[model samples]
Target: MRIYFLSRRKLILLLMFLITIGGLLTINLLTQTIPSLVRTPGTYYMAKTQEKVVALTFDDGPDPVDTPDILNILKEKDVRATFFVLGKAAESNPALLKRLVKEGHEIGNHGFTHDYQQRKLVAEMNQTDQVVFNSTGNHTYFYRPPGGLVSKTQMEATKRNGHVVALWSVDSKDWRNPGVKQIIDNVMKNVFPGAIILMHDGGYQRTQTVKSLEPILNALKASGYRFVTLSELRTLDSDLK
Candidate 1:
């Protein structure tokens, strides 16, 4: 038999490395969990209501391919949703932006480039607002930061710009292309009254996301839940307060 022990210096180094890793893991977990726990003013993760209503929000949209398909499904189901559009995409597809407004869907500013730079938050928002206005002649009151990542200063700037920071409670995780059934289940399992459900219509190959929509819509409707745009959901939330 052989017995060995680590030297004092080696033992200290290993312990420090493990501690650093633990600290990082703790930070990552808190980053994921804190948003659901804390709701700040002028930032909406979900509404506060018990009216069997929820908001459907799509991000990174105005894709020429998938967005139209998603819109058609919504139309067939007679459900209105909110599209958090990128200014670059909206600039490329002005007609789609117009169609969104014409079809009774609400538009939200998702930033100009979908880049997460806290210092440029206000500028990105203004650019997106301009593009949406130029296409639909209407301004967006909701602003969802790219990846739902924002700083305290950025949130204050968003409020000063007269836009509500929109976040989601139930994320479909469809962006991962995790199969249509899984996408449907992700939303169905987590959804609640006044929930803000997140899905992406653009930013990649989103065929699975498009495929998941009809079934998710049908399931929610069957559960006696009504869909509303973020603005309408906000109105319902306000009535409660």
Candidate 2:
């Protein structure tokens, strides 16, 4: 009798396992039919299509004072870059948003309020995207966390909205009020093929960033590096697809 009971338990457990697997497969198939209303799972900000090209991602932007200067340098250099503009600032300064679009720069959401206390606030993400996307749809489905703060939950939220979560490998510390030369040094030291460089255009004390942009861009350009926007750069490989 004891042996028979154990055999029954094993068969029951196997049956339950098969049921769960079948349910998961059904759910996954249903999701594909529902269309992608969420983000894909990947942390890419540069194209893997080449070896020497680097993508530049500037966050916290639409600053009426400093951003224009950065745009000018980009135009003069004839290079394309990505700007993750905060939704609140973009809403307030429509002209700045227009400039970015008109100048062929890719704009992405950086949260509406620029608060970084939470890893990934779904409420904040929804609110920011509603304001930025429904209003203009100028932004691509690309976003960065406020201050690089991220968690598994937050990252999942980023995907649900059909956006990619961009994290930087090279930070210039421009947010900490570093001088131009030091910021330049930081980029030069950390740069490599397929590197994503982080700088700010709209956050507090971004003037120092403006000063650093010209020299850094010139140096990188001189070094056989080509600048591409984060979206363009994200085609790193077919693996992401």
Candidate 3:
């Protein structure tokens, strides 16, 4: 077998390539970790409280069927939740938006569409806010970005629009059409006091979500967990401070 060696120039190029890859990896790591380290103002993932309370937030809704089902469950359980709705959906189902407010549930802007393009973030937020205001006769102060995604510019725009970014801590992953048991387990395993539990009322078939709701509510209520809206959860956090 003949042995081959890289030339000095080729060796230098290989070293440079490795260094470039390392730098990119470092940047990716920092991008993932730094947000957890530095908290953005007016943005909340979970409230800072130990009151055995959690906020139930539903996104991508005002769905004609699923929203009503979820609402019925919440009404039956005597629990209030926050619904982050898309403008297009709300426009189509204005009555659902009105019903949400009438039932003591909070409304939050989830943008105009499910698209999460950064450049249209503010525009989408504004459009959704307008739709909500038109339907509910009340302005929304909370904005949960579509898919829980945010950027510096998006955060800045959200602040400028006077909306607090509402994010969730416990994700049920029901969007994946995970089985009812798995959805319940996903939440039960991760839930904590002041957790903002993420579930979806729309954007796909949510039968599992609706089916999982009563059991999850029963389990949490039995554990002495009270469900509150995102606004109430924020108020609790403020009271702690």
Candidate 4:
């Protein structure tokens, strides 16, 4: 019989290496289970382009109060953004949906009840699409699931609805009601060409988000970045392809 023992220092180093590898594997698995942003290849996180352009997207909107304020801000900035609206919200505020189209902003479906169940999502998406078309005569080409949650089944349903799943490359984390400065920093730090920035308008008290937008927009513009709606970003991607 032969016996061998690793030196204490070498054993510690080997254990550290194994721990690191295990941590990485766990992270990879967790990311795969969740809806992905930039690292997921098949997901539409953002466009791949060199045009110094990005898409600013807001979710859960058409709020009578916050949505109007957000629209005012975007109008003042002369920027067109994409708004993913709830079907219920749109039905209640059909005029707001028309305002989105009138302002040249794009409207996408955010589900009827913000539900992500596969079968429910298909119905929700279809209902929202009809509401949007009836309200604004504009068909929603993008579907961003509530909380960006999507299963393979949900993805297939979205495709069947003739909508592309549009996720985001940069999340402002403003939903937590983080300070205005922190929200600005989160976005400014991650801003990049073809990045789709995620923010919200109607989910809750979104004052901080609205407050953060102006500074973030000014900073990005000063950095020579152009803002586009998500559909426009897709056009850029299609051209590239």
Question: TM-score per candidate, in order?
Answer: 0.88, 0.76, 0.83, 0.83
Report the candidate with higher lDDT, 1 versus 2.
Answer: 1
What lDDT would each prediction earn against the true structure? 0.89, 0.76, 0.86, 0.86
Q: Residue 2's C-alpha lDDT in candidate 4?
A: 90
Q: Model 2: per-residue lDDT, tens digit, 136-220?
A: 6754577777766666787777788777788776778777675888999989998888878888888786888989898999999
Backbone collisions counted per model: 0, 9, 0, 0
lDDT of 4 by residue, 1-241 (tens): 8998999999999999999999999998765544334434346888888888999999888899899999999999999999999998899999999999999999988999876454588788889999999988888999888777777777777787789888899888887777999999989998888899999989788999989999998999999999999878988984457
**49-132: candidate 1 lDDT, tens digit per residue:** 988999999999899999999999999999999999999999999999999999999999999888866557888889999999
Clashes by residue pair, model 1: none
Off by more than 4 A, model 1: 1-6, 16-42, 238-241
Consecutive 10-residue window with the lowest summed lDDT within model 2: 32-41
Worst 10 residues of 1 by lDDT: 33-42
The segments of candidate 2 whose C-alpha lies over 4 angstroms from its true place after superposition are 1-42, 45-50, 236-238
Winner on lDDT (1 vs 3): 1
Give me the overall lDDT of model 1: 0.89
